[model samples]
Target: MTHTENTRVAVNGYGVIGKRVAAAVAAQDDMTLAGVADVATDWRVAVARAKGYPLFGATLEHVRAMTEAGLDPAGSLDDLLGAADVVVDCTPKKVAAGNVERYRERGIKFIVQGGEKHAVTGHSFTAENNYDTALGRQSTRVVSCNTTSTVRTLSALKQAGLLKKARGVLIRRATDPWESHLGGIMNTLVPEADIPSHQGPDAQTVDPELDVVTMAVKAPETLSHLHYWTVQLTREASKDEVLGALRASSRIAFIRMADGLVALNSVKELMADLGRPHDNLYEVAVWEDMLTVQGDEAFYAYMVDNQAIVIPETIDAIRALTEIEADGATSIEKTNEALGITGRLVPEPVAA
Candidate 1:
């Protein structure tokens, strides 16, 4: 569909992430906020309608009214499937999976949140690292926010041939029980002792040959999740080179190369300073002195807040996966180059 007509987009969930997605879509010049589908009769729906966003099928009449107003409303979730070219599945994990299959069968494009419960048929995408891969790809899944942040930096390092092996520890805070019925809260500071933690596997899905390990700790706070990364480099790459490369990435906005220890609170403040009116895709608060250079091993620590780090990436992914045109091709090329997987490579060094 042409950009003018492509304005019609549907959002399947209306929670925090869904609401943000809806706002982002509505703000776009080429896209229109078609409707929203949620079981609950939350105030957000009214907020959407007040902003002239058409509310489609929901469990309640207020949403039904939106359908009557030329917005398609499917009282049954299945009815919502055929209504739009793109469906953003912000529903809970279990619900998201079923909807994904249904959309695939009906030949609809979809955007699934990282925490969704279902398996989707798209490449794992981050705008900075994987937008080129997402372009024209029918199905794409945005990786978890933490995964996006960590992988973006590491991917750049990999491109420079500085990264050899990687390990990380993630301390996450659970949201309210209603956030995700599955466990997100209730657990704090517990070490996930398994080698190659779940985050590592997620990263590998994007780059199969990457060697990485991860551990998890659940915190009580609900604002953002944090990560501590230790990487072993193949060569003697300086902290300045690493930070400079990271800053060069358009996908990364706020990066602080810490001379000493940098706390999570400080990172949050840096995020505030970046002054991104919308949630950012990712930011790097580098702990440079925390960088340990032991022989060939290089360890670095950093922090990323999940929501801010993933949202903008999702926006860029949708633009790439769909036929929506941006202002220039240069942005696309730069994003691909940052990911290290532009599908063009230089020959490895040969010994004399």
Candidate 2:
């Protein structure tokens, strides 16, 4: 459990987030992937095994099954946590409560994702928005991708004293392309009679004073979630000033028509072209052409790469919960460098 030079970290899920976290941990100079565990001995376990991560069963019963499946699980989930400096529970929403208790019982620092409520971790973490508040927390929940986008945008405006209040409609994707069964594939789906959905409240979990409202719906597409936001600014500012303020943060990337970026698919294509691990686009893709202002009303639309945005935040949450790196900026910079994160659309800049 000692974290001086290289902190040991374990991931307790082999699905989307867990696998990504494990890979991210291995990519870090200051952290090593201890092991990754899961209950199901499915293809994901096979993928984890193929990646050469020490595989473990989420429970003892799964150990025998996992071994029989040629996964060669090293031990149980508890064993992985016991031997690691920190563990991140990438388990599903309701599945995390028991794991959180196990983390507490083992006195192991841990990280959770946004799917769970705030009670699971007692602190909401958005690396761009609330890294300072996450310092020294025993457990941190890296806010959901949608919430991450919301807070990052508003927090930037708040820092520049431009945000008065904001409201937005989240045109969410049906699901990841792989999860074709989980959402309405051919139709737009709305929450059962809920206004503002859960995103506004979820963002509030990170910053209690944030004055934002949200309405959400799911479209048939699956690549990314698009957000149409309107910010009521306290001061009159030009479109350039607003974009400049948002572009000030490395976590947000600008894609304007001038850059030949016309749609969200182009951003995804760019992430793939960069050969990003998991094709992850850590930066929130802001549309420069979409940014407009009239008097105090500012409007813009951005696309959230749902699958990849939270990956770096999970890394930052690890640093915060474990105090492995006390300075949030340093940790974020290190993570970004390790993952080759950049606000620049091109990996290498062309000559002037």
RMSD in order of candidates: 8.2, 1.7
Query: Candidate 1: TM-score?
Result: 0.78
Shift in Å, residue 49, candidate 2: 1.2
User: Which tens-of-lDDT digit does each residue in 112-202 have in candidate 2?
Assistant: 8889888887889988777888877788888899999999988998888899999999988887877877754684565525887899999
Error at 281, model 2, angstroms: 1.2
Write one digit per residue (lDDT tens) for candidate 1, span 122-224. Answer: 4787665666767776677878877886788788778777789888888776763246566565543566677666888888777877898888877866656
Question: Ten-residue segment with the worst summed lDDT in candidate 1?
Answer: 338-347
Q: Show where candidate 1 strays beyond 4 Å.
A: 3-7, 59-83, 116-119, 176-188, 254-262, 266-282, 287-295, 326-352
Each candidate's number of clashing pairs is 7, 0
